[model samples]
Target: MVEQVDILVVGGGVNGVGIARDAAGRGLSVWLCERDDLAAHTSSASTKLIHGGLRYLEQFEFALVGKALAEREVLLRAAPHIIWPLRFVLPHQPHLRPAWMIRLGLFLYDHLGRGRRTLPGSRRVRFGKHVTGEPLRADFSVGFVYSDAWVQDARLVVLNAMDAARRGVHIETHTRCVSARRDGEGWTAELESRDGSRHFVKARALVNAAGPWAASFLDDVAHVKHQHSLRLIKGSHIVVPKIFEHRYAYIFQQPDRRIVFAIPYERDFTLIGTTDVEYKDDPSHPTITAEETSYLCDAANRYFKKQLTPDDVVWSYSGVRPLLQDEAGSASEVTRDYLLDIDQNGPPLLNVFGGKLTTYRKLSEEAVDKLAPLLGNHQPAWTADARPLPGGGERDIDELLADVRATRPWLPETFAWRLVHSYGTRARDLLGEADGLNALGEHFGADLYQAEVDYLVRHEWATEAEDILWRRSKLGLRVTPPDVQRLTDYLSTKR
Candidate 1:
């Protein structure tokens, strides 16, 4: 079958979804195709922070810092549910960069950006005074507290896709674009769906937003050559038992001067990581290396009261960052800035290179702006100051929570707050007019209810049980194997 659209976006990662959403909102007919499930790759495997890279200050990347910091507030306001303010405690170590440099970086970070809303600026915390500093070693007398945002990376992609679809973008999951060719005036793209269906889509413009596969898609799939090259750097993270009492995440400096984040994840686990190493292998199946694990563990062990080893790790994941090579000596030093390669020889194909989660919206807006001329009469960028995500459209979460409590007063305050944090205003959408715990149908463990699973399957495009247990929600930490089996069987029946 042959279909036509104004624009075709090839990857369903954050960048691709962002582009599709922007393009669709701009009144362009758009089609977004993802080979695997949305966010099945690097977008979901991020460090899960929407912060201005504090460490990037060392690299003197002021422009990136400003852009990210500005977007932090933009996203927090846009999706206050999944994205919220996080306080980071950076304990000073003697061996690391001196206190002066740290202070300088923090000062620049505070002043680099213009607008600040929910999050406060950097402040010095005393180990004896603040509860967050209590877990630190006695020698760590002082620390700096700065603002950043934590994002549900996977759902962020989903929210963008949802918005795109709502704004008239055709979203196809498990559909891979095998080839693309320019036919006289426009472009012809071939796609294969999950059910062994073949499709040919013709479009005025094509966007190669494939995360790690940007180069591969351009060269092999699109049959075009690119001047820029993508440098794949594998960054891995380990989820271990919660080691600290504070709600604030820790930003620790390693011996090699690389900073590792010990973030509070899923309420019960401390998510620590990220080792940056050159990865030349497949981006699809990047595995956590022992050396990276050791590096992360060592970095965590430096400041935390409890030591972490491979055995303590419950889950480990690695993501290959499709970085635009800028001739940096080390992978860690590579710039996180994205590049738009627009080819106007025929129909323009905008290939996005390197970008972090924090800067995706801006990147998308800029990308569409670049391709606007090719598709004459394109709509102006409208995503810069958008409102809440699909479920997070409301301004008041407390009001929504009160509504949820009224509906299900049996929900404990903490657990109810957890649901509110996860689902935002959509808490009622899942719990729906259910009066009590039983009305929620079944308790699968943790805060997970049967109603939530149904809502995910129906509205959020949840296919597998793991998608519900892990990515969609962190109920995997609490749900039993038998419960998971039951859910899996139920999902199978739905198919």
Candidate 2:
């Protein structure tokens, strides 16, 4: 049987799923397919920040910075559980950048975006009196404090997919769009699942939101020709033991003028990244090179009193950014802004190019605004004023945590906190009628239990151990090898 829909969205990254959610909300029949797990590649690998690019101000990218800053507040309000305010401490290095220049950049960041009501603005801090100073080198007597937000990057993608499914969008993960043919007034796409089962769908419009494969998918899979090109820039990050006990994150500026972040991760580790190297290899399997690892370690060592080496790195990840190709001298200088190219010569086709995580919501809204009108649908733009994503209704997460502990007194403090932060109000759904920890089922190391795993598999499209451990939650850091094997065995039986 050939299914029909108003739109066929290729790719399951933030941009793709965000577009699907917007289109579905407008009463359009939407079908989205991904060649791999949602956020298996680029989306999962990020510095995990939601902020206006403060450094981009050096390049005079005021508009992009302003747009991102505005979206930061919207996202914080929309997903308070997964997104929260974070303060960044930038150590003073007069040789790299003058103090006046740094202050000017931060001032613009604080005032550029219009609706900056919630988060506190940037300020200067005396390291000798600040907690962030205790971990810094002695030379760093003065630093700057700025406000940003942290996000569970992978969970954001899953939430968008979940919301799209609720709005009648069909989401197919681990399913590849083998070929797409433009028929008279629509597209007939051949989709292949992991087991080699084939299915067909016809749609009025086609959307290519494939992140790194945006250009390749057009030439090889869809067999369409376009002039757009993507510059694949590989960024790598190394995770090591926590460098400091403070809650504040550090943004270090290297001599090369590129910035690297050392953010607290998984409650026990520090995430240091990322080196910008032009990549020509397969985007699916990007690994952190030894040189890149050394670079990150050295970058962190420059700022923190606790020095690091390559051996200290417990885990590392890399992602290829499909940035828009501009005539930039260095890969790091490439613009983080996005472009939406729409072809109206025949059946409408929209191609999303060169976007950052901070601006994905606006990018998706713009993509739908352009493509939705062409499909004979005049649904007004939404998603800005819409209700929060699933499990994101509660604004005060600390209060929610208090309530969870008050009600489920048997649940450990750590376990209850993780639940409220990860699943928000839906944590109640996972607990169900369970009265104690035993009812939560078998333990899988750390605070992970079978009940949580079941909820993820049933709701969040978690398939493999990595998806559940690294992406869905950072339990991989605490789980032993045998525990992971047990999880794999359990998933196999369920399959």
Candidate 3:
């Protein structure tokens, strides 16, 4: 039997789920399918920041910067549990960029976006007296501090899918849209699950939110013609032991004019990234090259008093960015802004191209706005003024954390903090009627108990151990291999 819906969204990344949530909330019947887990690819492999690309100012992308800056506050309000303010320290480098230039750019970043509240503006700091100066090389005496936000990137994607599901959208993870054909007034799509089961759907409209695979999906999967082109760039990051003792992150200016960041990660480690190299390989499973690893270490070594080598890297990840093709000399210079192409030659098909995490909500809002009218639905834009995403109703995260700890006095401080930051009010739901740690369920490793694991499987569509350890939470940094095997065995039995 072929099920029918008003819209069928292909891809489960940020934009895909974001659109699903927006469309479903507007009373449209929405169905979304992903070839792998939610955020299994590019969406999860971000530098994990929500900011008004300070560097984009150099590229003269003022419009993009302004749009992103506005979304920063909206996202913080939407998901305070996973998104919060972060201060970035930029050590002075007179030889690379002048102080005046930096100041001018920051001034625009502060004032360009509307509804900028809660976050402080940029200011200069003395490395000799400030806590951010403790780990920098002695040569750096003055620097600038700016505000941005950090996010659990993968969790952000899942939460959008969760919100969409709650609003009556059908979310199918581990399901692939094998073929989509426009027939008469709508589309007939064949979807295949990982277990080799196939299902069919008929929809009034189709949305292609495939990120890195957007273009190829048009050619190979959908077999459609398009005038759009994508420039694939590989960006890689490395995680090492904490390089600094402070809570502040560092943004270093390289001689090549690109910037690298060393941010706090997983409580005990430091995250450094991102080299932009032109890529021409399969987007799936792009591994970090040794040269890329050395590049990140050298970038950090240039700024920190403590030197680093490739051997110091505890973990690494890489992703291919499907940037909109433009006349640019370098990969890093390609536009981070996105484009929405609506092919109205047949039944309306919207193709999403070239977006960063900071502007996903806005991109989604626009995508739905364009399509909703085409489908004869006149729902006004509502996501901006909507309530926070599930588990994010509480505005003050610190107060929520304290309340959880107060209610569950037996919960350890670190464990309680993790839960509150990861789930906000939903942490209590995970605890249920449990009175103590033992009642929570069997301890797999670290702070992970069976209760949380079961909650992930039941509520968040988690299937694999990596989904729990790496994506849902960064517990992979602490969980033993034996513990992972135990979790895998348990999941197998549940299946």
Candidate 4:
């Protein structure tokens, strides 16, 4: 007898996991598979902001902006630890955009989609009075301060998958759906694991949420007829030493009618990014080009007093965004909005295309709302008001931090902050019955210990150093080559 499920989701990106979580919560048997580790692609390679795309307003994407804004509010409530409020300071460049236009855009952003219930509204600020202006060039006399939120993007994807697993969704990472064939009664597919183990699955419905590979999955695996096209655009980011010490992040308006952000990342570095170059290479192995690095440096240099060079870049990453093809002129101008295509002629099928990080929950809810009914699941949608994601139970993050400090005074301040912020309430479980750092286990490097690695491998499906160091956490930035080798050795035993 072959294994079967109500839904078979192909992809482990944000949308794939989001759909699994929603479907499982609504009482559906779901099985989701990913060829690589979860969020090892576009989901982890975001600009890490949970904002209504402020620049999109110029393109008149009002509906998309409002939809994203509403999702932002919901996500904040559901995952307070990994996702929290962040203020952005955009230095005024009169030539690029007028002050009134920005003010109008901010007003609309603040009030869109039920308005700013918990986050602060945007306002104009003078450079002479504000602290964020100190790092900017002397030419910027004034700027606008607005509210958005920052995310541990990869962690967001993991938490969604964990929550889905809790709700009885079967998650298979490092496993690929090699072939999927739709029979009139249901769909059957062959799954191949990384270790060469194989299995078959039958499903009542299939969802192709394969981020950058959605179209390819349809063309190759599902063998279904469809007209959707995905324009692969590569966006790259460079990490340099901390350029600004302020808590606030910067969003610089580029002369090319684009925007680049300089945000505090991993405590010690500033994250600057993102060029919209059309890409034709493999999505999995995308790396930042020298030109992209210089472009980002220049984008920051235009407004920042501390100049950046290619040598200053400590790390870099690039991800191919599989945007839904449109008639847009430039790659930068393409819509970040997603489209959910559902075909219900025989066994149901759903396809998700071209979505940004900010709107995954809404997209998932909408996807399940369409597919769940076809499988006879009449359960009402519940993820919007559902319980918080894994380890995000604590609403008052500061209070939780204070309590943890009071209880574990031996824990270093920075270490404690990282723990509380990264794992939240689950930090207690990871530190269970331990009084000192040494008890946590062998030191891998920096603050990483054997205990944390063990916890990750057991709970978060972390099988390799790359998954733990880069995706699950940014500890890769602080670790040495030998340290990585040691981690690799340890994970090899685990796998």
Candidate 5:
């Protein structure tokens, strides 16, 4: 039997989840399928920022920069828990991009966005005055400070999915769309979930919002032939112990003209990343090589006071950026902007190629708007300046912390801060009626409360322990081997 729906979204990445949320909110019966866990792919493995790409301006991608900048504030308000304002210090070097040019880029970055709030505008910083410059070499006497927002990329995707589900969308995790065939006036698709259950669904319209798998999904549609290509470029990031003093991040210019980000991750570690190289391997299995690790470490050592080795790495991950090939010479130069191709002839398939975490919401809105005419009906775009996600409750962080302390004064100040960072306004929901630390239940070591673990499994669709330990929260770093085994064994019993 085939279950019918108004719309079907392929792939479970950020773009697909964002589109699903938008379509479902508009009162459409939306069904979404992912072959793996939500954000088990590239969506989770990002440098984890929601800022306008400052480096894009060097490529003269003003329009893209402008769109990303505008979305920054929207996202911050939408998910303030996970997305918070961050300062970046670009240390000046003589051989790198000229200072005047860098200043010009910052100028455009500051003015491009529409609604700007707590984020401070760009300004010059004296190397000696600011702590951010402490880790820099002696010769680097100047720098510029600018604003951006950090995001929990995995949570962002999960929150979008959760919101979509709340709005009556049927989300099938661990499910893959095996086949799609044209029916009388719609399409019939078969989905096979991980539980060995096969289900069929019919939809009026299909969206190939599959990130790296867009092309393959397109091929599944009979008679919808096109020559559009996406270049799969793999980017990797490494997490190491904190190497800098200040909260501000660093954007270092490499000799090859590539820029790398050294951002403060969590509170104890630093997240340095992202090398853009052509990937010919499977998108699902993109792995970081020895060379890639060395490259990133080398880049970090070049600009910082201390030289880092691979031994310092505590965690690492890699993801493929599905880039629309526009004939760029270098992978680093490929457009971070997205492209949409709507097939009106054979059947409706909106193919999304190339997008960033910062731009997913806007991209989804545009995609839904494009589909409105094709579906023979339309709804006004609503995600603009809209809230996403869970955890980003309306209450300000200060008040929320004060309230938590009022209720549970025995809770460690540091742990309370962690709760605020993780759950934002929803911290109370996670903590519940707990009066003290012990009431929070079993601790899997280092702030890993039983309540949080349960919340993740029940709400966030976390089936595995690693999802809780590593991706959803970085408690895995602090938890011991026996503690990890305990959590792992407990989750196995649940399944």
Candidate 6:
């Protein structure tokens, strides 16, 4: 028997999963497929920020910034465990940008989209009086502080997929939509699974939320023609040993007018990123260039009292952004806004172009709001005020940690903290009836044990060690090689 759905969404990135979740909530039968693991590419490689893009103000992207600013709180409310408030310290550089300009940007950031009500407002801090300033160079005395939120990027993608599944959306990971064609009144597509098997799917409407592969998916897979094109821009980041002891993150302005962010990551390291370079290669396996490594190091060196080099980098990653093509002078100047163009010449077809992770919910809401009416389904737009993601029920992670400890006092203090922040209230579900650390089963490494692995595989679609280590959790940073091999062997048995 051939399978069918109301909407068939391709690509399992943030935008793809977000769209699937929204469509499913609106009472639509949806099916989403990804060639690889969810968030295997660009979505997982983000700078991991839920910000208003403070730099975009120079580009006069007020509308985009406002749109993103509004979603910050909405996402925070939905997933407080993975999304929490973070303050940024920007050391003043009178030569690069004046104080008044920075203040104006902060003011607009504060007021735009009613950005800061729950989080603290922006303020100026003196290095002499503030603890955050002590790590900076002596010459750097004062700077501005602002509010933004951090996200567990890959987990955000998975949570959306999980929510969609709960609402009856069929999710197929490690499955590729090899061919899609408009057939009869709807669309017929072929999906190929990982073990060399094929399945046919029919859908009333097709959605192309393929991220960097969006343009190519239209050209090659669907064999559809359109005027839209994507300019692939590569952004890279470097992780080094902890640069600062505080919880505060820093956004540095470079001489070239672009910015670099050094954020606290995995509790033991500083995550510094993101050099934007023009890219024309395959987007699947983008690696950080040596020059980008130096650029990020130099960018950080200019602000901090401590100096760093390429050797200091413990790990690095890169993602190719499919920014909508425009007549911009440089890659940095290209707009980060997204476009949704629905082709209705044959069956109703929706193609999602460039978008940032910050505005994915709004993008999904708008995408479905446009596509739903065409399919004779006028379910009111939901998800904005809807239920929270799987583990997001508890807003106070500290309290959740306290509660988990109260019940499972045998669990290490640090171990309990990791579980609560990673899985929220569902941490208890992962714990099951385990009474002690040994009962959680064989230890893979660090605090990771068999019970957590089983829960991830059964619930979160983790099929491999890398999926658990890198994407599902950043435990890759702490686990040893022998332990990873042990995990790989164990997962092989489960598969």
lDDT of each: 0.86, 0.92, 0.93, 0.92, 0.85, 0.93
- For each candidate in turn, the TM-score is 0.96, 0.99, 0.99, 0.99, 0.96, 0.99
Provide the RMSD of all predictions against the true structure, rounded to 1 decimal. 1.7, 0.9, 0.9, 0.9, 1.7, 0.9
Worst 10 residues of 3 by lDDT: 109-118
How many steric clashes does model 5 contain? 0
Q: lDDT per residue, candidate 5, 407-468, as tens digits?
A: 88888988898888777777888888888778978788888878888888888788787788
lDDT score, candidate 2, position 447: 87
On residues 46-80, what C-alpha lDDT tens digit does candidate 3 reach at each position? 99999999999999999999999899999999999
Error of 4 at 414 (Å): 0.7
Writing each residue's lDDT as its tens digit, candidate 2 over 1-495 gives 999999999999999999999999999999999989899988999999998989999999999999999999999988999999999999989999999999999999899985846888889999999999998899999989999999999999999999999999999999999999899999999999989999999999999999999999899988888999999999999999999987899999999999999998878899998889999999999999999998999899898889999999999999999999999989999999999999887899999999999888999999999999898888988888889988999899999999889999999998898888889899999998889988989888888889998999899888888989998898888899999999988877765
Q: Which is the leading candidate under lDDT?
A: 6
lDDT of 1 by residue, 254-326 (tens): 8888889999988778999788999999889899988888889888887876777899998888999999898
lDDT of the structure predicted as candidate 5: 0.85
Model 3 misplaced stretches (Cα beyond 4 Å): none
- Of candidate 2, the 10-residue stretch with the lowest lDDT total is 113-122
Q: Residue 408, candidate 6: how far off, in angstroms?
A: 1.2
Global local distance difference test of model 6: 0.93
Worst 10 residues of 1 by lDDT: 111-120
Clashing pairs in 3: none
- Model 1: CA > 4 A from native: 116-118, 442-446
